[model samples]
Target chain A: MSRALGIEARDRRRAMLLTAPALVWTLVFFVLPFALMAAISLWQATATGMIRTWSLDNYTAFFTRPAYLGAALNSIEITVTVTVLSVLLAYPMAWIIAEEVPRRYQRLALTLAVIPFWTSYIVRSYAWSLVLSRKGVVNDWLAGWGLPLLDLANSRAAVVIGFTHFFTMLLVLTIYASLVQLPPNLRRAAADLGAGPVAIFRHVVLPLTLPGVMVGAFLTFALCIGDYVTPQILGGGKDLALPQLVMLQVGRRADLPMASALSIVLMALVTLAYLAMARWMKEPGK
Target chain B: MIRFAVSATYMALIYAFIFLPVYVLVLFSFQDGRFPIPPFKGFSLRWHQAVLSDGHLMAALGHSFVVAVLSSAVSLLLGFLAARGLAHARLRGAGVARGLITAPLSVSYLVIGLGLLASFNLANVPLSLMTVTLGHVVINAPLCFAICASAMGAPQLAAERAARDLGAGEIRVMALVTAPMILPALVAAFLLSMTFSWDEFIIAFLLSRFDVTLPVELWSLLRSGLNPKTNAIGSLVFLVSAFAVLAAELALRRRA
Candidate 1:
């Protein structure tokens, strides 16, 4: 009995050693950050950049301020819009890439999906500004046709367009990963069972790829909600996104308490969304 | 037949949507226009000249390269160690450990940047290129851990057992047998670390006191308004990143 107990002890020590590095990193960086942010959120900042003792003033101020709450809602609204758009665009692309094509084009198609990702996120947003600007190519083309050129530059439309460009690739890539994992035989079996193409897709493919869809939604929404550059550049100072507001508080106002409050709220929201995604989609393989 | 035609047309539009911004960025790099605005006056090398002549831009580029290299090296080393440790041990807490390691990947950069400042004193740490690299290590190590852990999992047991049976020491087995098997994963992790470090804005922006990275510089430039010179630099960065990713992808596939 003593020998067995000793062996068990030894095994446990090895396990602890294996897990130590990751634990230490998370404790120092992630958890500690949250703890600090939470503390700061409950405090107030003075004119001289001095932080006062703990109070619920910042959170109270946040809750009471219409602009702050509005910024938070705008973030949610933008995230929902981007997620819906990305999923719609990605579904068909993933379908074509998974079901309609020969295997030879898989690598090429995947490469195409990833190439845009290699470009800088801010650069891409700025490029959309170029393409959608009133005097830009799209408007110029429309002008030649004697049609009224739509002003997409520096509006909520610009944010959507920029996000679509940036995020559609991610959705397509993720959905493709899940789609490829599915056995082709499932689709064939559905066909042989006399289901129509749409029915087979609805019953077999959609349910199977639901995990990917959820993951894609999580990625897009999480990113869109926290995005500062896109809203700042594309929304042209008119769009009052939470991340942009947080940056303003930090950089311009130098109000650490307000910034901390905003960061904590944003982090909590994203963490909740991520947990929901994990619950729905636990495709650990991809 | 009409359905087929419509689908084909849709595919073409999707392709155009994907590639159009890229084409515009690349094309505008060559245009003689002073701004991103059109008229396409003529082709010239003036923008390239401006990009090359700016010392600040060049300095930012250099800083970015240094951070990328340092972060990639450190993250890959630490990650490889963690992966080997986890693989060798009959661990009970591996799931919790893995969860902790991957948590950084999901956290937003704004929160991370804010958190780092709130947690640490800048006077002691004194944000610089060194601090920026440290921040990169903090954010990027988890990515390496995830990639290397999966890569090392299935194929490692054979090599480890073989080395032990051959009377090799633990370090010898790791350096010779385990390292070879996981080399591709190491490469992938390093490339990913490099990419993340190069592109990372928030942490670097928040932490840097003097030595700013290219992304931060480019962002500041944007606030000052766009120029042809910025386009020139943007195009160059896009080219380098795309090439690196392509090379890394090919190398990974070949090894597989």
Candidate 2:
């Protein structure tokens, strides 16, 4: 009984030692910072960066202001559109990489997909701005063809185009990994039974790769919702996203409380979307 | 036959779409033009010449390199220790613990930067380049922990017991037996942390005042409109960083 008690105590001590670092790091860095932000959101800020008495003024101001609310709504709309587009584009690319191509070429093609992602995302977005600007390459080509000039930079369309360019590789890779893990025999068996290719895809391939689709969609949505740089560079100063608003309040306004309040709202909105997606994925049949 | 043709065509187009911007950036870097886009107005090395002369760009590049290297190094050390501790302990709540450790991986950099700013302000810590490095560490160490812990957790417990029974000290057992086993993961995590630190913009932008990173510098240059010199600099940075990632990936693949 004495020996057993000693061993149990030793085991417990070891467990505590193992888990302590991770717990402490998360508490101090992750949880504590967010908690501080939440607290700041409730306080009023002076111009001198001092906090005053707590109030709901920031939240109320957010609700009352059309511009802030509009920016938040635009973020949501962009995220949703980008998520859908990524899934549509990724599924086909994943299918080709996983099933259609030779193994050697598949490696090269997959590498190519990821190469764009390796470059600086900011630089890539800026490149899109250059290509889509009025005096840029896309319009230059249009003029040569006697087509109408396109000014996509600083427009909402530019955000969509930039995001699609930046994120499609990640979506493709995630979906491709899941797609490859699916047994080829299962797909072949479906074809062997009298199903057309599209039917087989709808019934067999789609269900099996739904997990990848969900993962890719989650990442894309999460990224788009949080992204500010892409919108700022491409949206042409006209369309303000949530992140830009948050930055403005914090950086220029020096209104940390307002910025904190706005960030918390953004966090809540994203959390709700994530939870919805989680539930939807869990109940795929419904 | 038609299906095959269609797939090939689309695949080519997709590859082109991905590569076009990269090609354009490189192409225009060599052009004698004054803008980011190209009209093929003969070749010149003027932009590269300009990049070479920019003292601010050089300083930022040096600062960025120091931060990336230092942050990755620090994160790798802390992560390895934590990962070893995680693997050795038979905790009941390990799953939840692991989830918390990996949570930083999914959180947006923007949110994390904002959180860092709020926390640092509350603590009355003056933000600087060092603070920016600390922010990177806080965000990246967990990433290293997750990667290293996953790799290390797969080892058999019996091996650890055997080392202990053989009279090896705890530190020696870890250094000789466990450390070697998780080296690949350590390397992978280090590479990832380096890449993340290099490409990082949001946190550095928010946290640092005096010394800005390359991404922040590039972003400021971009706000003024399309500059060909910006394109040249952006191309060089992209190529070097992409080469590093490619090399790391190849190394990882070989180890795997």
Q: Evaluated with DockQ, which candidate comes out highest? A: 2
Models 1 onward score TM values of: 0.94, 0.95
Q: Can you write out model 1's per-residue Cα lDDT over A1-286, one digit (the tens) per residue?
A: 9997885586467547645776676788778877778888887788886565978888787789999988998888888898999889877877777766678987687678668788887788778888898888789889889999999999998898889877888888899898889998998999999999899888998898887788789989888898888898899887599999999998889888899999888987898898888775655642
Listed per model, the TM-scores of chain A against the true chain A are: 0.89, 0.92
Native interface contact recovery, all models: 0.55, 0.53
Chain B TM-score in candidate 2, rounded to 2 decimals?
A: 0.92
Please compute DockQ, using alpha carbons, for every candidate against the native two-chain complex: 0.61, 0.62
lDDT by residue for model 2 (A216-277), tens: 78888888898888898888778699999999998788999999899888888878878987
Looking at model 2 chain A, report the run of 10 residues with the lowest lDDT sum: A10-19
Interface RMSD of each: 2.0, 1.9
lDDT agreement with native, every candidate: 0.81, 0.82
TM-score of the second chain for every model: 0.94, 0.92
RMSD of 2: 2.0
